[model samples]
Target: MGSCKDEDRNEINCLFVHGPIIIGAGPSGLAVAACLQENGVPSLILERSDCIASLWQQKTYDRLKLHLPKQFCQLPFLNFPKNFPKYPTKHQFVSYMESYAKHFSIEPKFKQSVLGAEFDNLTGFWMVKTQDFQYFSRWLIVATGENAEPVIPEIHGIEKFQGPVMHTSVYKSGSEFQKQRVLVVGCGNSGMEVSLDLCRYNASPHMVVRNSVHILPREMFGVSTFSVAMALLKWLPLGLVDKFLLMVANFTLGNTDRLGLRRPKTGPIELKNATGKSPVLDVGALSQIKAGKIKVVEGVKEITKNGAKFMDGQEREFDSIILATGYKSNVPSWLKGENGLYAVGFTRRGLLGTSSDAVKIARDVADQWSMINKIFPDIDTKLLK
Candidate 1:
């Protein structure tokens, strides 16, 4: 990569990357970098945080585990350790990600948050500006993925609530909330898991189920639910697969509506494909709900001083509020893809999608690299110097 000084004497370094400049050092970015390296292409990864997979390293709760089997969650070039369980813990997954990076000799520049990125029409390159440096590259890979930022829903009168209100991103454990009545907003996987964790800590948690959801048993008949679905999908149509899944789920987990968790009219897979909303895979929360340890509540109408008033006109008191509201992609806030800019990990299909996208991106970039090299021999040696 070439470097130059600006005329303003500001000492702001400008770098011209020979290969793609990847943003975010999450699993997606790491996977792309590894694939590119295997394809005999170099890549520069920029991480906003100090460590790789900042979402897993810093934001996630302690008890979080891979919702899918380890095989499905593994990156493009490396596999999870043989000793690891089918569902690896959060720490174990992070460790595996670290090993994957090391195996590929991928060293990312940490704390280089991209302020903005745009395709420079005149230069035919991507101009990515960070807090400290300006990067110009032929290829730009946005691996920041979805869930780059936590989504805190706007609750009416939330400011009026006297209790400590926080998002699940900052939540670590329920041990600190022992014996406290906690109100968890949202009915997604995180919300369910958090409520389960709270119950384990002897904390009374009331989870808000605002909308219809699909909760499936993590496994069925000794096989993963996802695996079963995939196996069925190969032979049956999508609607048939959904019907089969719902049938099995009903038989396995019983009718969740009786417990206040209503099923959506749209099939889980269909809904997911359409909206990127994942069906909740039960890890132990349903049992807690059935046992009456975790109470289910309706949507909040307004946050009161001690708790919240529900949409059903019921009010409840709680010591704290945990917003398991989920996360969203911050891509549109900073990136304007036009020319050679590519985005991976936003497919909402999770790690499987990430791995698939990473390989495609690497191959595409490699093909262009080869074509450019053939057209301009010694281009890297002379121009990149």
Candidate 2:
């Protein structure tokens, strides 16, 4: 209901005087909005893309499924369909996100590409400028998430290689690479799964796993490993939980090092909690590897006309390379000033932490908005007059 043209005609755009303004309409953003709404605080969500969760709809490969089970991935104040599987497919999760938005009745303004934002000391509110509009609010929440941008690491001779190179974000299935020897780089979840997808299609996939990583079965003894580890993490010390995970990994995956699946110097849970690096939640990748369908190699030293040089001083030819390198968190980029701005879903705790933080922030806003107004006193100046 606001226009940049009208704001330009004057000095300020006051048409949007909602409670809090949230950028990005993904699950995290929607969580923040829903939580605030429950507290009777309305929030305006500005999404740059056409639909919510555009990343999942556009970027995720077809063979992808949630590394965690569905019970562990539900948004706050919402639940996945009862009929949904434990570990839902990527498409199923996407559809669940859509239904979550609907159930919460959260309406996010689409295509509102934010150029930048600034806090006005005089008004004690945020002025978020998009390409075509300016939305003002008492608070600004940035929940664009860690994977808002895809990161492709620089490999030597990568540019000179004369074959198709793309990120796993652009990959859908292995059918396109059929009968072609494809190299899947990085040992992250995407890398493992993408290589498996290629194997299923008989694409002859080879993986470049540079370092040791802790891999676990998605389910052990008919129970999700995540459920057990998370329960342990909640009750036990971090160190104890970390060790428990290591033991579980050892028993289940069993000497991944022998298969070139080396363990990182950092323990699995320790690595994930300390930094945001994701560990593999193996569905069928390991079985495919053990079956000799997916071959593993070391890091890429360089690229050639029709091949890649490995760290072991061996060269292997490939038709293409898919970098599943992963993503980086970046909500801070939107803020020209940090005052009155909050970011969630960047803590690397994945969906659970993201959803929890949204609820926490929403409750904080509901409890303290009046205090913030009194301290700043600008709330009176722009009290929806």
TM-scores across all candidates? 0.97, 0.92
| lDDT string, candidate 1, 225-324, tens digits | 9999999999999999999999999998999999999999999999999999999999999999999999999889999998889999999888999999
**Most lDDT-accurate candidate:** 1
TM-score, predicted candidate 2 vs. hidden true structure: 0.92
Off by over 4 Å in 1: 1-11, 378-385
Where model 2 places Cα greater than 4 Å from the true spot, the runs are 1-14, 370-385
Tens-place lDDT digits, model 2, residues 344-377: 8878888889888998999889877757656865
Alpha carbon lDDT of each predicted model: 0.92, 0.84
Q: Model 2 clash pairs?
A: 212-262
For each of the candidates, the C-alpha root-mean-square deviation to the true structure, in angstroms, is 1.7, 2.7
Q: What's model 2's lDDT at 373?
A: 59
